[model samples]
Target: MTTMFRKALNALPRLGVQVVDLGPGAAVISRRGRYSATKVSADAWMVGGGRRSTRAPAEGWGLRKAAASSLCARHVADFLANYEVNCVFDVGANRGQYGRQLRESGYRGRIVSFEPVPDALARLRKAAERDPDWWVRPVALGRSESVQSMHLGWKTMNSLLEPSAYGQQRYKRFADTRTTQVQVRRLDKVMDEALHGIANPRPFLKMDTQGFDMEVFAGAGERLDEYVGMQSEVAALQLYEGSPHMTEALAAYEEAGFGITGLYPVTREETTGRVVEFDCVLARVSSVPGSAAGVRP
Candidate 1:
């Protein structure tokens, strides 16, 4: 009887039902799906052939509470099927969420990830442990190789190599924060070593290192040829706080034998009150003569 009840419950659309199995005298039931903060009293509810005590949905007991939970996973799956990409370099890998997402979406290729934060790097490593194609590195990529003090944000979400005074101040609004000294390496050196002795290296690089995207390319130098395409986070609003402007950054790509092929807006105007908080510029390396012969602008 209990097995039948469990099967029936599982068959129901897993929208907002948190089912807990407690032996005999105790069973706890809570809402699943969407995140919320509310308390409800436990009571007995009838199921299959038994009556067990469970907490009603914090709001109420009905399917109406589950309407907001959309099938986002399906959409993401569709996207992965349609997009054609091979090698992926995830800069600012954080906890390797993007890497995991790629794998889950059936992306079977080399995935190189970089994370400067020690704690975050640890988590990223654990997350990618099962994936052999996922490579995680702990060095921060910049224009030069040097030890730099990075500002640690409250929840690892706001950590940045170049945090603005305003950003720091805003971060202080919350407690529980710490800073650490991290090693910074030049992308030029890293890429040269990674692509060394290889006949043809065509990798897709995605960079999101707060305000240090331009410096990363600066370090890539001539080896930027190994990367056929790239997506970099360009901070227009934070440009005044040390980030290079979009125009200047794109010019650097042009000098490096790359052309701006696409742009994706990260933060919209309705949320940030700015034209575009973060811009993802897609660049492709030129294959023409004298393309790789000039210095970055």
Candidate 2:
């Protein structure tokens, strides 16, 4: 595919075609990158030295721009609406997947996304480019502020912990494929710098840190008091070393003044039919804020 595209591009010198390799088997072609490559096509060669939807986007970001970037999660939508959540901390955001979903669900508030993977960060930045309120922080969150070697998986399963045997048995595809030294910061510290002490933050944390969810939560410190709700991807099996059991996580959250509101299945052992992973949606044990406040109808 590269050879074919290179050979074709060889003849388009008259056109100001600048192509940048964005990821594996993916490239972004632009006149000068004035428009984003949300749905770029390598086949859309220089037609009269102009780019449109047929060649490149001529106008704004729209539904025709890229693949479906929406997850109509009714439960989450209801929770976010009811919580009056004004600030969303999207931890372990690989490529702005959840932020995009929130936008599609009519959420028009501050979405701060954290991503550590370089390749994934580029994609996340591109996705966040059009949204003025969406900010992307190229870093990871952990219990401490330092550099850590993060295990790289297929972008989704990447984590700060090595894949355990329990994970490999469920899916060999989730094995740690590589390692990268990434900067890690405490969530409480990051919020101080990013938010600058904005009053009434009404924060909602959405954590999908593979098996390191609790570690990431620890980074939040006392700032957990500012959150109205949270949702985390919890491992049922020991997917990583020292990973807490799902029940333990639930108990801990309950002790910390939160309650399990919903559980969404994420993965299961194909052979035994036991769910290996699920997302735990949590809300404060006692209400303090609002209902349907910061979301669009």
Candidate 3:
């Protein structure tokens, strides 16, 4: 009866709940007071049908809304409702998390996910196995069509074209952290070969390549019209020694006739030594009759 009541309470809307981690085998539950919005902490074994465990507290409504809004959810929602986004391109798809999020967010569009790492590609394939609308590709997007050496990390998510040699590398424990050969192709070539049969040319794209976002845009070249909107991760700091700056990459998108619509930071804390990653969305802007090239949307 207690468990059932707790579950029922958790399902109620507007009920504020807080999970407090107490280290090793202990935790606390804090519920909003009946008379006030302030949380009243309590010692509890379990809440919401889960064992007491040390984990981060659930974010407040404000933080949750901010996080969701930062991902350009409003723009995506507008595109889904207004535009014909029948197809979506998820470049550098890490384990298909973003694809799953899209599906969960009511996006009924065909997804083409690309991951360069073999392990990640395999995982992505397994994750999207039940979704018939999704297709997985294990190829790196670059400027040329050839075999290129890629740096692999201990974890597949850390794999990228440019790996850092310093700054607390995560994959240093691996016995063989050298570069591995991988197939690389231009986005235009891949689209021409794979998606040529589709009647529509333009597709909504989401790119999150660590530092190779510009290369992928360059490979698209004159085929920029084939995409209506793009959401990409822009790294502002020199996180990796060989990584490109966000400003340089945004300029490339502007040259390709795209306008920046949104810029959101992924992290909130400024003292963590972590550089802010911007989730940027670019839309194709029509050229004006007598406008300077420097004008932006």
Candidate 4:
């Protein structure tokens, strides 16, 4: 696609299309041909204000909401740049999508991804083979170092825990999933081995491990203070067994020396207006004291 077409497509939400982001600054702006797009280069807010016509939707509901989502995503991407990120731990990195998205968002640092799904591992290894800074590990992260059964979803929804009925009711793609055993390890042990002798590595940890976000953190507590920023996908309801939901997840992060500074909706239920999950960005409270990003006591 041409540059001008891409810019025009960024104004799609203004045209009443319910465009949703697949990742930071990436959107499915096409309705005519379903030509999905990664819209990170240009500012959607600027394009909407000047180019996209408001003559279409009087409420501007789609434009307002979708633009916020895209912009919030962009904000998270920008926020990461505040720190000199030595590496981004892309946990639950299925097919290296997050790593690819980070690079497209102008993050030129090293990306260390960990994946254990057999099919995803194959694709992930091949995908990151060309980028020297993008590294992949064939391992799963959990509370302990052992073998655990991973419930397989059709796509990126796979998890170490079994899906709850509520999650299945909202989305069946992960329901009645097949399980496969995979090697699991703790983050503290893995990080020490992975980044040995790499002095002063200010890592940024991001997790999309379905419902195992808290457990992933539980395993990384020793190194939690070392990361510059951390982001996790949080569920509103119990989607998996004993996984931390919205309130509990927030408290957990607070106790971990991080402050909840950003919340971007990742999934929502259209029928009952329930938020399935969201990407919560947390910065160390003491790291940036008195700044807006710091979690207020």
**What is each predicted model's overall lDDT from 0 to 1?**
0.59, 0.74, 0.65, 0.75
Please provide, for model 3 over 123-168, each residue's C-alpha lDDT reduced to its tens digit, 9 standing for 90 to 100: 8999999998788888988778888777676464354555455323
Error of 4 at 73 (Å): 3.5
Largest lDDT belongs to which candidate? 4
- What does the lDDT come to for candidate 2? 0.74
Residues forming the 10-long window of minimal summed lDDT in candidate 1: 62-71
Error of 1 at 134 (Å): 0.7
What TM-score does prediction 2 earn?
0.71
TM-score of each: 0.61, 0.71, 0.69, 0.76
* lDDT (10s digit) by residue, model 4, range 186-232: 99988876665567677788999988888889898677888878889
lDDT of 3: 0.65
Candidate 3: Cα lDDT at 243: 63
RMSD of 2: 13.2
Clash pairs for candidate 4: none
Clashing pairs in 2: 52-56
lDDT of 1 by residue, 1-297 (tens): 567656755655476666545444444455543323222113323232122325444333321122111122223233333333446777778888778876776778677888988778899999989887678889888788898876676454434445556555444533445678888888766764454444545566777776777877777777777665676767665522677777787777777766765454454333344534443435453432235632233
Candidates 2 and 3 compared: the better one by lDDT is 2
At residue 283, give the lDDT of candidate 3.
Answer: 73
Backbone clash numbers for all candidates listed: 1, 1, 0, 0
- For candidate 1, give the lDDT: 0.59
